[model samples]
Target: MKKKTRTRLLVITACLLLFGLFLRGNPDEIIPFGLVIGGAALIIYGVKNRRQGGQPTVLPIMTKEKEAHYLESGMTEKEIEFFRETMNQTKKQILQLQENINQNAKLKAIDLRHDTLRASKALFKELVKDPQKLHFANHFLYTHLPNMVDLTDKFIEINGHEIKTKETYEKIEESSQIIDQMAALIAKDYQQFVADDLEDLDVELSIAKQSLKRDNSL
Candidate 1:
């Protein structure tokens, strides 16, 4: 069960138990039924969150631009739908991190990487057309992006306590470095795709020019 869901259930159960006792009823009998219902609700919530990849807060928003780009990239309707959901979830996480960065000056390092994430996201939208490139891009789109978001959120949570110990400082430093590295790797992946496309375009243009010259000679 997710920690929040479990905590909520525990609080509800405790409150129900207190209420039963206050009424001078059989606490054991009253609490058992409440516990069973709460347990079921917790199980349901946990399953739903698990299916959502533990991001219960993220709502999938499919933008028109995303649809147009995906269609232009030759993705089938089904693949477009799948990738849309993936992109929405990633966008939610990235937006969350961005909002946090804006609010927290201590998270300046995370803020610095925001542009890299955005650039990589744009490249990813373009590169998804090629299955071979998409295979590698998945690491940035699915894994590393989410990891950076989670790490930033956790770091912010840790900082909220205002406990400035050496251990906490070290953790903050480590997280900053890791987030920076992930940003660099994502940027590098996107650049590789762009470089490949540019090279191919150059070759095609050269071939076309040579063919035109040969025709003129003939």
Candidate 2:
């Protein structure tokens, strides 16, 4: 209530009380009754919403541009660039390693030529005693070895960084598929044979020298 309004009401009540003879109702009772009504309403309103001073929750409004700014602040320039470059470099290195493996396979093919020659000679000399066997051996030696050598050699040529024809590519694929195992098996056996031959030749030479020394002593 305003001070002026309250003062006016007090004056009215005071005047009524001073002249109770003219007023039927008691002025003191009226003033106290009005005061009680006002006080009760205030107490009810205060009690109904009495939460203990917690702050109100309010959501902030943000735009996409502001969200992008927040993300950018969390990441540095070098970190982003490094991630991009690392991915690119890793993909490049993977391609290069695949090329390297292809080249290594070609090199392994080329190395088999030595074993092919040895096995071809051995088969012609030892396994072809009969006429029919000889015919078959010759046919295999002529038809198979040359084709294998040519095919694998083409791959070796590619490993040396040259391009080949489609026909040559097909031949390489065919021969490599077949002779992949043959080349390895033959190469190991031929190497062992050569090693044994050299060892025997050394032993014979040593024995021959001993016999010569013995004859000279006689």
Candidate 3:
């Protein structure tokens, strides 16, 4: 057990002692040594399991330095699994870290675009129904469109530049449409981006797995 684990055990032991004392006047039954040890073991076992903590989600996608940062940032097992699924085509667990960052940037852009588009669409609807809403729309678009456009533009650049895959075009195109649909609520294209990002995250992780040709692949 680690120092922390020992400390926790000590704390639990103290609580048990206090409880046992509190019941001093009750049943004069003596506490068995075996029972005491058994209870302590259970406490230690729980502490160990709690300390075991799951492997990181973004660990496979980051550089050593970046991975340290990721762990420090407290990634959950589910998040790491999701991250692995996104950059499935990676060459190695660690190598996937870099790809994860890129995919993350892309996903973040999509999210931002989604929020912006959703707001824009809402404002657009309001503007159409209540002319007074134009001021709000103009305020939002003028204040934020440049940033949104810049992010989408970067997403386009990254996807268009293509790290790999013939389907890259389709992915980027779908993302663009998703962004538009969010802003316009036209034909329900936004779902595709969410679905595709999840799939791609898995796809990328699958690609990184080692075949019979090499070891240490994911």
What RMSD does each model have against the real structure? 6.8, 38.5, 24.4
Tens digits of lDDT, candidate 2, 1-218:
75456545655665555456336656666667656655655554455435433445332444566445434545355543443343343334334323433556553444455445446456434331222232333334444444445555555565454666787677667656665654555455434435656899999999999999999999
* Index of the highest-TM-score prediction: 1
Give the candidate order by descending TM-score. Answer: 1, 2, 3
Using all chains and alpha carbons, the TM-scores for the candidates as numbered come to 0.58, 0.25, 0.24
lDDT digits (tens) for residues 1-218 of candidate 1:
77687668766776766676659866666667666766876777678668777655444566787678767777788886666566566667667766766666656654465566466557656654553356656777777767877887887787777668998888878877787777777677677657877899999999999999999999
The lDDT values for all models are: 0.70, 0.50, 0.48
Q: Give per-residue CA lDDT, model 3, range 1-218, as digits (tens).
A: 58677767776775676567557754433345435656776787677667677444343434666345445556555554543343232223223222332465654554465554454344344333333223433324343443344445555565757374667767666766655543333213233323545798888777766453366543
Model 1: which residue pairs collide? Answer: none
| lDDT value, residue 113 of candidate 3 | 54
Q: Is candidate 1 or candidate 3 better by TM-score?
A: 1
Off by over 4 Å in 1: 1-74, 105-115, 127-133, 201-218
Compared with the true structure, model 2 gives a TM-score of 0.25
Window of ten residues with lowest summed lDDT in model 3 = 89-98
Please give the distance, in angstroms, between residue 30's alpha carbon in candidate 3 and its true position after superposition. Answer: 99
lDDT of 2 at 42: 55
